[model samples]
Target: MGTPKQFLFLELFMQLLRIAFGKNMVCYWDMKSSIGYRYSKFTSNHLIQGSANCSHLVYASAHFDAITFEIHFPQHDPPLPIFKPKTLKQSHPKLKVYLSLGGDDDANDKYDQLKYLHLMEGSEHAQQKFIIRTIKFLKLHQFDGLDLAFPLPRNQPSQQSNIGAFLNDVNRMWGSPTTT
Candidate 1:
């Protein structure tokens, strides 16, 4: 949701974009997951300064049915903007904008090895909090779905039940919006 304060300004700004670029306007995902972008640095660009923080956010948004903004667990506290209703309203209403999880492999690389894994392997309290916060963040951000991009921890005997419970709770609460 967007504040009423953003309505007039957002509409006007979007309209200016439409006029400037016409129907052929170059679309893009301006907001980004900082950690995901950093980790994806390629060998070709290793010596060069990367153009900007967010890539893979195609500018031509209208051509796609969806756009996903992958969020490292730490990216969204409540949620981030540019994904809010006012911005999405410019796109096809049916467009699916998802907030994906688990870009922390590199994020946690410097510190705790299983930072993302903690959400899966930690105490029930931490795990549940992660799940609940994720749900709340998505709703607040007007995200259409959740993407789980991490592999489950290896060789944990209890993971079968734990994962099942996690899936059940997320599915029960989130329905089709939750994707593996």
Candidate 2:
């Protein structure tokens, strides 16, 4: 019999194989969605900057499905514009691209200043307009879907409700594509 540590390592390796190939699982990572852009470092210069190490695994893993590039609305532009789909298509043809909105910077003062007045609470028409505009923008760029990353304090009831409404409006506007 092998040493305890060796056996544990072997078991872990087997589990990883099962999860990585044996099962038809799909894993997605929210790359560059929050305060830092560190995750981008590992991807290709086009996909992300620091994503070098995981680039191989991201390509090799049959279980990995899509990459969601988070965009902090009103704070930064979409990073998808810089992404090169050729690399991803070569490795995983089914890999889909999505845009995530309302990350950390969306709550900052700069974001507040630039916030679309139409997206304010209790304005269904305004919310619809915002969603329609986002869909059109993403369609123009060939994005698959939208991932709302709205971050609000747990105790803020009003903000949470408004966010829910916003999501509903977006879903309704985009029709929520089933593929991505």
Candidate 3:
């Protein structure tokens, strides 16, 4: 049997081995967890852990290469951050933080998030506006990049092509100082 500290070291060792072999060590910190969602234990009645915080990652920052903060598409022109990431970035200067867009928490919703994504893709003006606003949002929040987490609809070739085009457009404008 290994002690808690020994197990922690073993976990770190395994993470290093995986990284050495070129495996990505990415972590997604959901907004729900960040805003205080406690996780309970399955067996017996006991609380396992509290909401996730930057301190949790700061302690074992070496194990992660990047961390993605999940957020939904903007209802307005520019998206707002659910939590401030300045402290985390300052604590671990080398860690890359990304803003993940387009995740659905409710499966029972009549229209999927993909519907809105498709709508945005259909209109060139909408796509351009979204790209511009997203870039500014990333710069304002000090995000390393954007992660589009929108899942492709089944048997929708046009939607897939549209997403590709959107990605290309974003990449093109990402290097520009002003995308107007």
Candidate 4:
């Protein structure tokens, strides 16, 4: 049997292997475990909650590149409490923590994701709202970046173009010195 440290090392090695050759290593944390980080086994019985956190695996990861906390759709508004940037930075200062923009978290979430994409595609006002809110969310939580995980099954060329435009706006806004 492998010791805990050995298992952790193996996990880290596997993640690095996946990230090799131009791929980025991004981990998904489930929506449910918002409070997992707030407790120890000594403090709460919710220790083994099914969510990923920097505490468990980040240290083992050697290169430590980047990790994104997953699934923040427009429907859910502000979702879970992600790990603080300061905490993750103290461990691996260069490691980037991003907030994932869209992914279906459940059956109902598929509907919400579709709506989210439709709003993004159809309404410039909605797009601006999303960008503003997302910027605020990132700044509030001190996330280093944002990751767009396409929310819908886009069919038309124009649909893809709309998403591209949305991302371009985000990139433009992201590079600016102003926070507001």
Candidate 5:
């Protein structure tokens, strides 16, 4: 699930996939641009507005199964509250939606702000707070699950350990099945 800020290419890709596979595929929008470090204030409205005119094209397309809008988190700040989609899935009740955490880049600074000295070994308190807040936000917006995208820095022992701790914390908080 790559980031599709404009959703134009994603729309076309879905169309092609439908033609080629003859199956309904899911389209998860891994929104890298919304991460706090690069896009702290970004919101779903940005994506919606950017691709406003393409809503009809996306909704009318027959290739997509579910369209999960991933919002990468790069801050210790509580996850952004979900904003209901105005177009896609308005008529479909079974479409799966999700709110993703982390991204391709490591959120070391953000983790530091949260007072988690080790990225991977966040305290139980920190993990619980993150998971609880995230779940609240997801439920508010009607999301179905979460996607943890914490990427470890390669060849860095300390960073890798931190990332491992982070994953462990996440697994403990959200459980294995909740991860995407």
Candidate 6:
């Protein structure tokens, strides 16, 4: 049985569905768990399809306004989807699927993700390139949008400003009718 909060959330979600005014309930799925095929059967049927079994129970895809696949970075080699996002989209047309950038990594070299995010948006040229490539990657992979998952570390003013500027650029690009 779920907690009272979970039940209340479900009730709210159901009400939203009835009224056709859904709240933004974002579900973040880590690439490692998704790619490893360790998802539950309910998840498989509703959100993603996989052969492996698990005990964890995930809410239906319709409950979420969007699902974000975590930890892809802006680089020359774009990410390839191990879990087929196209299938999920086809199954739940109203559910938005986003590709997230920057996340914690176990490997020491890739651990400081904020640093990579900074380097990606260090200059005007680099920022533009990152946005263009990200857009292209999203289009290619059928992603609804890009999620900048970079955390603003405490006392890091420069990093925060860079992230803010980069976000503004991203918003400008996506908000424009001409750009995709």
TM-scores vs. true structure, each candidate? 0.45, 0.53, 0.60, 0.58, 0.48, 0.58
Q: Per model, state how many residue pairs clash.
A: 2, 9, 0, 0, 4, 0
lDDT of each residue in 1-180, candidate 2, tens digit only: 235576467457646765677543333344443324543333343233222212222221001001122122241344422343344545555555565555444444543423532254646755655555666656665556655554445564655446565666667667756312
Candidate 5's TM-score reads: 0.48
The better candidate by TM-score, 2 or 4, is 4
Query: Order of all candidates by TM-score, from best down to worst?
Result: 3, 4, 6, 2, 5, 1
Measured on C-alpha atoms, candidate 5 has an lDDT of 0.45
Please identify which of the two predictions, 2 or 4, would achieve the higher lDDT against the true structure. 4
Model 6 pairs whose backbones collide:
none
Q: Which candidate model has the greater TM-score, 2 or 5? A: 2
* Alpha-carbon RMSD of each model: 13.8, 10.0, 9.6, 9.2, 10.7, 9.5
Q: In candidate 1, which residue ranges exceed 4 Å CA deviation?
A: 1-82, 104-106, 151-161, 175-180
lDDT of 4 by residue, 99-125 (tens): 665444423544544654565566666
lDDT of 6 at 73: 34
- As a TM-score, model 3 comes out at 0.60
Better of 1 and 6 by TM-score: 6
Where does candidate 3 stray beyond 4 Å? 1-14, 17-19, 22-24, 34-81, 106-112
Evaluated at residue 3, the lDDT of candidate 4 is 50
Question: Which stretches in model 6 have alpha-carbon errors above 4 Å?
Answer: 1-24, 34-46, 49-81, 106-114, 151-154, 177-180
> Whole-model lDDT for model 4 versus the true structure?
0.49
Residue by residue across 1-180, what tens digits does model 5's lDDT show?
A: 336653567567657766776544554453433454643444455445434223221111001001122223333345443345434356444455555554443334543233323424645665555555656555665566665544444565654456566666655766645532
